[model samples]
Target: MLKSTTPTMVEAGTKTKKKHRTFSLNAKDKYYALLFLGPSLLILSVFVFYPMLRTLYISMFLTNTLGKTTVFNGLGNYTDLLGSPEYIASLGSTLVYVFAVTILTVGIGLLLANLASKRLPGIGVFRTLYSVTMGVSVSVAAIFWLFIFNPSTGFFALLSNMVGLPVINWLTDPTMAMWAVIITTVWMNLGFTFLILLGAISSVPTTLYEAASIEGASERRQFFKITVPMISPTLFFVSTITLIEGFKSFGLIDLITKGGPTNSTNMLVYRIYKDAFYSGNYAQASSEAIILTVIIAFFTFLQFKFLEKRVNY
Candidate 1:
């Protein structure tokens, strides 16, 4: 009996040691996890989080041209912006620009993706051309299009001359300026959107199309029924990203129009830039920046709340 009890005691001791070892390993794993995540967290804290919080704080106070806080204004900056007709007009232009860019970019991207998805000969060349713009910088694209939209010695001017048509004012006219900026933005963004949608379409299983064909579905039917539903998740993702990008667009507006022609193409981001840098109105710029952030956040929330439900996956 004594020998048997001794063996039982030894066995219980070993079991306790095993538990202790497992707990130690788990604690070390947690430490390693935090170690790996530390760099990323530090970067975000320094860049993204700090800047956002600082902007919010600055927006509540009046600031001089040098960005030094002069007085505590509470919500005065926000109220002033909301009341200003210029701000209102800028907001309206932003809405129109965002919607137009999002729609046209995604639409054209989808069309190009579908076309490139075909198995025709030399399709690789077309695919390469479709995605080439993704590598072009915003400034380069803007300058390239500047020549295209130039009233004199530009592509459109030459085309008009050859066709015996009037040379349209592409960038000077108020209405045309907004559309010109939108077109430039769409063209610049098309490559990215096309690549994303192309990947999404490529990931869709071919078996679905085969099944649809067996059921006598036409090409259009297969596209709508099989392809669309299958790739709905990616479509939703691309749409959300494109929408946010449209809201934050600045480069093309800066280089192409500079929010000009009666402020017709004045987007919110460009408005923030002009206020902060050009006009030296730091308080107003901070407030406008905060407003833009809130608007983007609100739209993103709406998309996730309503649109995400439609995503198949």
Candidate 2:
């Protein structure tokens, strides 16, 4: 005898609960996603976009030893920089560095990742120690390598005596300095790159490995066929990043090698910096920076167009 409830009321309550449930997803997932994404977005906005805009704006003028001046030079700065021998040589050197670093980082990173994926004892400790170098700034790492390669008072000098070899001026010599830089960069960066590859490799479903094993696939064959294809996207990503960083290398060139014994190590980024700060020709430096930006942009585009297309499903 209590009361006759309308079906509409019950149906409305049911619909509301259903809507709420449909939209919900274990709040933990949402929180974790935001936690992971927030840091990366902040970094990109602060470090990448802000400086990019400022650099582009500063490139459109003329300045010299007379005083600070902006003469509305249009594309004249770009034309002159492209035509100059110094700029051309720097561009060539920059390309070489990009290739060297990319190849080294990717090759070594993938190899280390493969080894680490085996779940060996103490792998966690080894991984942490390997990545510790990445915490150091590039300038600091460059200086460390400078000391290590020093002729008279360096680790190499002591090692040379162990083998009865004469002391070699690795940093002061034009030929060896760039190699030293590359080795240092590779050693410092490999750990993080390796971690990326290791994660990518692990995400490959265990079923795939079992299937490969069932088919009598050797370990090398399984790696080449399954692991590589699955992890290709990560590899491409790391290589592209390393390439861009190589082009922008200046701290090491300035702090460690000083782009000497001649202009051998004078990367484009260092040239841009020297022109702006040392020579007081901000316009020229900006112009050079623009050129570097364009070059990097072109490579970035190619990477997205070709490499990104190959990302694994």
Candidate 3:
């Protein structure tokens, strides 16, 4: 090495230093991050996780509301619910609605997604108009729908006259009420499901569709063979979401049906809500809530087992 001939510096006298950064938490940044996370963590623990744990605990007990003592019932509640006629009917109704809504929502959503994915004229405006319902609160939508499906002085009456259709009193008739609620629920939610599916469909490479078309695949064939496969993952996601929402359905039951017309639409969530708030059976309601959660969890696990495995990507 050669030494520099500068007046005050030789080669050994000068060196360059590189600055380095570490992941050590500084007071300001650490505090800010903690502040950002504080509310969420608090909410998760207090409102969500705590209540869930408490429900689980209560599910194991019997309580005397009059005497003010919660004794260990030890699976009695589950047995009673399993055997009781009303509880069984509620469970059945809930399941029927779940299946009905899940099928309609996914099918309609897929169709819309496919249509919108083609970028047809005026599709964006159509998408906005259709999807606005998703932003409308479920309860609010159901209340509005209840009025629409009401027998007298509502849209149903006007439509029946205009189309010469039968006057259907959906909310009052036991046979028609659940169907009306199901249709309303599906219509309100279809937009969100469509948007999700459209994202997945658009993400698929155009070259694939072009190749399929060149190979003489019809639109139906292309849909089933290419589009479905490409969006299998999104389908799985959408189906899962639909299934969860169907299981937890309460707003429609409360606002539209009120579990009414001889308990034709007694969804588990609404039953739990009514039991706790309306009937003042906190212990039983807690038990019911716990049972519903377990059923949902079990069904979800089953879905992941049989359905989730089919996801392409």
Candidate 4:
């Protein structure tokens, strides 16, 4: 009886010792976790958070071309921008550009993803070839499109003349310039969208499809009812990122259109650049920057609020 009671006490002590060790290890882990996060936190504060705060502060004042503060304008910059025709036109262009790019990218991505999901010989090669655009940098892609859209000697020019397709100045024409830019944007963003959707589609369990087939569900029904729900999260993520990308797109517009033919392609981000770098009105640029940030934030918040509910997980 004494021996048995002594063993029980020893076991209890061991358990208490284990618990203490675990608690100590957890504390050490937390410390190390923070230590690991320190570099990232420092970088974000210095680069991202600091710039945002500075932009806000700068927006409240009028500044010279050299970015020196000239006068305290308070909200004058904002009001002036709202009333300016150029600003209004920029706003309209931005809206149209964002909507077009977002719709085209997601739609094309879904279509390509579905096609790539098929089990065919050499399908992997095809998928890889199709996703090659993802490796091209925005500047490079813009250059490629520029060559294609060049009015004098581009492929489109040759083809249009050959086929009697009624060639117009793709980059310089105000009416068609935005469409050209939109087409370029959609092509440049296509690979990323395709790859994301492909991964999401592949990750879906085959068992679900089999179960659906057993219930006499058609392929279209299976895709819409089963595949979509399983991959709704990826869809939501892609849409949100693409929306932000559309808003922040400056490289393509700068290279291809430069907000040309009466500023037809003048997006908000490009507008900020034009004001700051070209016009030397850094304060007004900062104001537009803040407004763009707010607009992107509002849309992102809306997506999370309404769309996240439909995401299965």
Candidate 5:
């Protein structure tokens, strides 16, 4: 009886010791994780978190040219903006611009990706040319388009002359100015989107296409049935990114249209810029900035909630 009891006690003590060791290891790992994450957290706190909070605070007050708050108006800036026709028009234009750019960019990108994915001679050269715009800076691209849009001596002018068409004002006319910027933006964004979609299309298993061919599947049928489904996840990601980028677009608008011939191309970002810097209305800009952030966040949430369900992987 004594031998049996003593062995049982020793086994229980060993189990307790093992548990203690495991707990210590887990605690040490947690400390190391926190140590590694500390710097990133600090940077985000300083740059992202603090500014977000500051913007929220500033949006509730009227600020001077230097951005110093002088009067607390708690939502007044928001109400005024909502009631203003100019602001409303700007918001509507921004929405139209974002949707147009996103749709055209993604559509054209997918088409180019599909074309480039074909196994043909000199395909590499075509691929290089398709993605070359990604290497160009936004300013440079804007300048290039500026020359192309020139009414008198640009490429469009020469094309018009060849076709016996009148040289249209690409940038000066209000209606045409918006389309001009949209076309430039689409061209600029095409390279990145094309590359992403091309990579996605390339990763799809060739076995599926071979199997489809065995079943007498046409190219269009195989593409819709296999390629699109296989790359749906990547497509979703690219669309989301493009949509957000379209919303945040400012530099191109600034360099090209300067908000436009009559504010027809004045997007939300440009409006915020004009309000803050040019108009010296920091409070209004802060409010507009916050609204834009909320709009982006809301759309992102909707995409994740609804659109993500369709992703294959």
Candidate 6:
């Protein structure tokens, strides 16, 4: 049976609707959101957007030694940089450095993480020793290695003498200079990667391993099939950061090799610094900087795209 609503009931329903509408945002909530977001937007504009825009703008112009823009060259700077031998060499060196560091650092970190994940006695000491390098600053770490690489009164030298092996001049030789830079960079970055992988390993469920064991799977097989797949996401994260750090590494190269012994250790970043500050070619530097950014962005995008398919979660 249909029932007719009374005036009191209709009035009450209308009042409830009106109350809901009153509580909902009209304009004040929008204002408050904008207010809260204002500082972050402002900071991003000033630090990120502005610098990027300015660099792009500066890349198109020739600048004086006195830091004054002279003439607009359009794409001429980039075109010239693409053909320059020094730029090409620097790009090659950077690629090699980045590749080596990314692979070696992540590989070693994963190994250390796996070792640390084991529930054996004194594992904590091993973990601590592995991650202790994280506390060392880049410059400080480079200096520490520098002392060890020294030919006279150095640990490596002393060991070589004791073993009757010829001492190697790590920083002086061209081929050895790049090796020194790579070693220093990998050592400096290893701790962070180890810590990240260790956390990832710890978060994984132990039941999976037990299940695999019950199936008569060996430790090696379980590691490859279970542990590695389970931790693929963390591996992707580690690879991404390691690649970024490899590209950004300048202090170690600067301190240990100085792009030296025939520019063996000069990566794109150090090249950028040398072009801008030393050679007084701000325009060229800006162009190279933009190119480097594009390369890094391209590889980073590729990494995400390729690695995304492999990540478990």
Point out where model 5 deviates above 4 Å: 1-30
What's the true lDDT of residue 97 in model 6? Answer: 91
Write model 6 residue lDDT over 181-300, tens digit each, in one string: 898889999999999999998988999999999999999998889888889989998899899879988888888887888888888999889889999999998998899999999999
Instruction: Kindly indicate the candidate among 3 and 4 with the higher TM-score.
Output: 4
Assess the local accuracy of residue 100 in candidate 3 as a C-alpha lDDT between 0 and 100.
94
Clash pairs, candidate 6, are: none
Per-model TM against the reference: 0.88, 0.78, 0.83, 0.86, 0.90, 0.89
Task: Write one digit per residue (lDDT tens) for candidate 3, span 1-313.
Answer: 0112363453223332122244455678679889999999998999999988877777777656552337888888888888899999989888889999999999988987888777778888877876777788877888788778767778988899789988988888877888997999899889899889888999989998899999999999999988898899789888888999998887777778788888888789988888877877777888788888889999888877877667675
Q: Where does the lowest 10-residue lDDT sum fall in candidate 3?
A: 11-20
Model 2: residues with Cα > 4 Å off, grouped in runs: 1-60, 70-72
lDDT of 2 by residue, 286-311 (tens): 77877887899999988878887776
Arranged by TM-score with the best first, the candidates are 5, 6, 1, 4, 3, 2
Best-fitting candidate, scored by lDDT:
5
- Candidates by lDDT, descending order: 5, 1, 4, 6, 3, 2
Judged by whole-model lDDT over C-alpha atoms, candidate 2 comes out at: 0.81
Give candidate 1 misplaced runs (Cα > 4 Å): 1-34
- Candidate 2: give the clashing pairs: none
Tens digits of per-residue lDDT, candidate 1, 1-313, equal 1334697897786687675643344667679878998899999999999999999999999998677999999999999999999999999999999999988998999989999998899999999999999999999999999999999889999999999999989999999999999999899889999999999899888998888899999999988887788778778888889899999999899999999988998889999999899988898999999999899999998988887777775
Better of 4 and 5 by lDDT: 5
Evaluate residue 174 in candidate 4 and report its C-alpha lDDT on the 0 to 100 scale.
Answer: 85
Model 6 segments beyond 4 Å from truth? 1-26
